[model samples]
Target: MSESRLHLHLHFHFLSLLFLSCVSPSYFSTTNPDDNSYVACGPHQAQVLTEFMNEFDSSHCNLSDPYNGVWCDNSTGAVTMLQLDDCLTGTLNPNSRLFMLHHLRYLDLSHNNFISSSLPSKFGSLNRSYPKRAHW
Candidate 1:
């Protein structure tokens, strides 16, 4: 291969690796159950999550599956990360209990069937201390 082509390929490969690293669920995970210092998710937060789960059809969801991740803050026990991709069906209601999770820093609800649901105004009320990333 030409030198320029080889260099371009290497750059593309590096960028792909970087993107994969950034998107890996384990990179931001804090929910390791075997750790002695692992903090349990707070009752209120857990209840809210349960209510949110109930609002949708979750036949695909494995509540005990670590890949359907939920990470709570070590000190406060507040949910900080949630990843429920492909696990839910049906529209996300406007008054979803999901909006009540004010402590979430990372939330990935991707690949769900929320096409019919409108964006809730309560999205503006969520914790915004972290930078937002909206793909569409």
Candidate 2:
């Protein structure tokens, strides 16, 4: 497989592991090295999510880390909701890294400027485990 495909595959599995952590903890062990690293959400996703959060702050619309509008799980630092509705971001491009947030269950991209842009097809691939509701 190509490098991009590898990333997508890893992203999918990593997200699935994260969901498992929230649902079935038996199969998702943070104490184990291999299992722990599999769902780490690492630097790439952190960078992407951090950038997205900074770019799309609902209150101030400023770019800052540790910003508001990010809801992460306590047990897992994986981001589950990016509440960016009523944000000031101008547009979402086809290549926007937002689709990489596979673990997200509540994404509020409404009221943003998606002019001339449509949601990426991969966004449909994102899913949440049982009991975790997904709302756009």
Candidate 3:
């Protein structure tokens, strides 16, 4: 598929899952960007996130089969986890799209090749911004 169409398709599928996901009563608010939006997560939200993801390099881990490498909270459509371990092989620079997932509570980038690059200082933003109950 064309890059634009592929992105749109990914967004559509992601949104479908988000909307279809079950939400708890305590997390049913749509006014905060920290949480998923009632309308859409927007292109700025999961665009790069999905673009940088693909099928795992190995098919041994079916439990983590999502080719997009993103897991969402559904009710709010906010990304909660990003497991991109051995799935992707690339360098994540300071401006990498991984930083865009502000709501992420669990991020696993282990077991992959970062090309010996250092984690960006900007990644510190995730420290304070991540909501409570963060886990990986």
Candidate 4:
């Protein structure tokens, strides 16, 4: 397989493992990793998330804000879930930093005012079952 395909394969594997794993409700309940004694969110993962957030006009939102949340795997230090709602304002481009989050299993961008933005085909690539829509 090509390098890109290999990368995609590994990415899919990682996401699959994350999705299959059962995490505690308390894990998702914490908005700040600092609140916990053990560091779950890796510095690099946090930086990527920060850069992704910077792509939009999220001046009103912060990492610890109630409207925005980030969950990271303690074992892998990879971001697993992101919830950014009602606080972002910008266009989501095809090459947005948001797509750099290969480890993300859950993403919520609800009630955001994104102007003239359309879901890029890459968004569909995230789900292996997404192509099944054609058969249905």
Candidate 5:
């Protein structure tokens, strides 16, 4: 092969590797058992769970998960948790919220930099499905 063609092939392979590394889920950690960074609280204590999370540093800690370093209490069946605190300044992808909310019963997005315009109109559905309860 020509030298220029060989160099082009090598560049393409490198770019592909870089893209895969950034997008691969395995590159991030899942909120599963044996992953000790976070713990799963049961569903009945959703209120309490949210209260407790409010005290922590909710900034994206570079976690492997797409929730951007946020953790969850996945012990309650398949319920997931997403917390967006003041430290969050960037626009959040709507698709990410949809995916995380699929099996979630509790979400704490308080204190974030989110604007009403950035939120989806269907966001009301989240409240309907997972009604906020008093902290236990």
Candidate 6:
């Protein structure tokens, strides 16, 4: 083969190997080799619901607050639910409102530490698609 042709072939072979390495299972697999604490759940279960609940409990000591956290499957979006009770009672940070507004449904913050105020007028704008009957 000509020198240029040989170099081109070698370049293509290297490119193919690089692509295969990037797409291989060893690179994309969900199994963590370091710490096996990772739970590989489906799209619905990918949300950080349990972690948010634990954080809420740890941060504010309220066990019954029903605000859940959701992580979008295809995107890096994470939607957190901060109920009025949690917000007013100082269990959840009010600054979390920015991240909690998108992609949510059921927010139950009843009988915890709220001061009994009316719901926010813009509460309906929140995207809370997950129903209570759904499992995630």
lDDT of 3 at 5: 37
True-structure lDDT of candidate 2: 0.41
All models: lDDT? 0.52, 0.41, 0.43, 0.49, 0.37, 0.30
TM-score per model over all chains: 0.64, 0.50, 0.52, 0.61, 0.39, 0.30
Compared with the true structure, the alpha-carbon lDDT of candidate 4 equals 0.49
Best by TM-score: 1
Q: Rank the candidates by TM-score, best first.
A: 1, 4, 3, 2, 5, 6
Once model 5 is optimally superposed onto the true structure by TM-score, how far is the C-alpha of residue 71 displaced, in angstroms?
4.0
- Those runs of model 3 whose alpha carbons end farther than 4 Å from true positions after fitting are 1-44, 54-64, 67-69, 131-136
Residue lDDT tens for model 2, 1-136:
4433333322332222222222222222122222333333334446656444333323424323232344544356565655444333333444655666666766654444333334456655655321244333
Tens-digit per-residue lDDT, 93-127, candidate 1: 57777777787776666555453435567656554
| Residues 1-136, model 4: lDDT tens digits | 4433333322332222222122322233224344553435666665555556555555444434321356677677777666554556556668876677777766655555555335557777767522222110
Give lDDT: candidate 1, residue 121: 71
Error of 2 at 132 (Å): 5.0
Best-to-worst order by lDDT is: 1, 4, 3, 2, 5, 6
The digit string of per-residue lDDT tens for model 6 on 62-87 reads 22322112122223223322232222
Q: Candidate 2 at residue 81, lDDT?
A: 57
For model 5, residues 52-101, the per-residue Cα lDDT tens digits are 33333324323333334234454443445443323332333344323333
**Which residue pairs in candidate 3 have backbone atoms (N, alpha carbon, C) closer than 3 angstroms, thus clashing?**
36-76
Worst 10 residues of 4 by lDDT: 13-22
Candidate 5: clashing pairs of residues:
28-64, 29-64
lDDT computed for candidate 6: 0.30
- Which regions of candidate 5 deviate over 4 angstroms? 1-24, 27-69, 72-79, 92-96, 115-118, 133-136
Per-residue lDDT of 73 in model 3: 61
Clashing pairs in model 1, backbone N/Cα/C closer than 3 A: none
Q: Which is the winner by TM-score between candidate 1 and candidate 5? A: 1
Give the number of the best model, judged by lDDT. 1
